[model samples]
Target: MFPIRDHNPSGRVPYVTYTLLAVNIAVFLFYWFSLPSDFALAKFYYTWGVVPAWLMQGEGYSGLITHMFLHGGWMHLAGNMLFLWIFGDNLEDQMGHVGYLLFYLACGVLAALLQVAGDPSFDGPLIGASGAIAGVLGGYLVLFPRAKVDVLFIFVIFFRVFSISAWIVLGIWFAVQSFNGYAATDDGVAYLAHIGGFIAGAVLVLPVLMRRGGAGFWARNQGKPPHPAAEYPVTPSRIPRVPRR
Candidate 1:
C-alpha cells in the first residue's frame, strides 16, 4: 500500500521539503555511478551511512547526518520522497523553512542513534531518508490527527484507495514497524529507527503545536486546511482482460 496524497494541504510552499529532495537527489547522483562494484559502493555507504559499530567505536560520527540522504535503491528513494512530499509540507508550514530543516536533521541523527540502541553491534550501513521522513509523519500525526490521508491498498489482484483519519494510518504504520523490529533478529530493516524518529517528531512538534494555540488551532482550522485542498486526479482501475472463457 502507498499514499497518493492527503486531503490536508499546506498554506504555503514547503521550501524545506523541496530543498531536502534536491539534496537527496544530488547526493545519489554523486554515488549512482559507483554501484557497479558492490564492494566499492558498500565502502562508500560504510563511510557515509550510519554504521552502529563505527559510531560506538567513536568514529564516522558524521554518518548520523550524511546517512539521511543515502538510499539503497530507486524504489527506496521514490518511496521516501513520496512520503516526504505528502506529509512534509504540512510540518514545514507549521515550523517554517529553517526550523523544519534543523528539526529534520535532529530527527535523522536521533533515529540513527535509536537504531544503534536497537542493535549496536551490527556492521551494516543504514541508508535512506526514511527515518527523517518518518519523523515528518510523526509530526503530522500529532498536529492533525483528524486530517484525511488517502492510502492505496492492494491485495494481489485487488486495488483500492481509502481515505482514513491520519491517526489511524500513522498509528498502524508505527505499530507495524515496531512489530517488525521485535520480530527481526538482524539486518532486514532498521525498523527501530522509524519508530524512534516517529516518537521524536511527535515530541519535537509539541512546542510548535502549543505555540499555535493547542486545541484552538484545531478549532480555527477544523484540523484540516484553511484553504482549498489539493486534489490528485483519481487513477482509473483497469479490468483484467480475458478471452471469452
Candidate 2:
C-alpha cells in the first residue's frame, strides 16, 4: 500500500518543504543539462553521490549533503517527493519554517552518516532524498500517531484507495526498511540511511514536542487535526451488482 495523502493539515505554509522539493528538481535538471551524454551523467554521479568508501577514505565529503538532491532515476525522485509532500507539511507546521529547515538538513546529515556506518567500505554512490524524507515520516509518526493517511493500494488487475492511521502506515514502512537492510546486500539502496534517519527524527523531534508539552499539545489541538483534513470522494466497491427484480 502506498500513501496517497494525510488527514492532518498544516496550520501555516510549508515554505521549507516547498523549497526542498523545488531544489531537488532543479538540481536534477542541472545534472541532466550539464551532461553531453548518459555516460557523462553517470560520471557526475560518481563524483557527487555518496560513495561510502570515498567518504570513509576522506574524499567526497560534501556529497553527504549534495547527494540528497541527486536521485538515480525518475521513480526514485517520485517516490521520495511523494513521501515528502504527504508528511512534510504537518511537521513544518509543528516546527515552523526556520526550525523545520534546520531539522531537515540535520536529518540528511545524520542519514548519510548512518549509511557510512552501515557500509564504510562500499564504493557505490548513495543518492536520493529518501533518507531525509524518511526522517519526516518518522517525525510525523511520533507527533500524530492517530492521524489518518489515505493510502492507494494496487494489486494485480485491481486498485483501491483507503485510509489508515499513521502508526500502521509509517510503522510498517520502517519495518520494511529494516527487513530489506538485513535481507539484501547488492540492492544498492541505502535502507540503513532511511532507517537511521527515521530513528534520528523520532529522537530529535521528541524534545520539540515535549517542550510544547506532549499530551497538552494533542489535547489543545485534538488528536484529529489542527486544521481541516483534506476531503476525498469515497468510491463504491467494485463487486458486480446483483440483478434485482
Instruction: Quote the positional error of residue 207 for candidate 2 in Å.
Output: 1.6
- The local lDDT score (0 to 100) that residue 143 gets in candidate 1 is 88
Which residue runs of candidate 2 sit more than 4 Å off their true CA positions? 222-224, 235-245
lDDT of each: 0.87, 0.86
The TM-scores, one per candidate, come to: 0.91, 0.92
Steric clash pairs (candidate 2): none
Candidate 1 residue lDDT tens string, 64-97: 9999999888888888888998899888888999
RMSD of each: 3.0, 2.4
lDDT of 2 by residue, 47-151 (tens): 888888998888998897888899888888889988999899989988889988888878888998998898899877888888788788888887888889999
Q: Tell me the spans in candidate 1 whose CA falls farther than 4 Å from its real position.
A: 185-187, 231-245
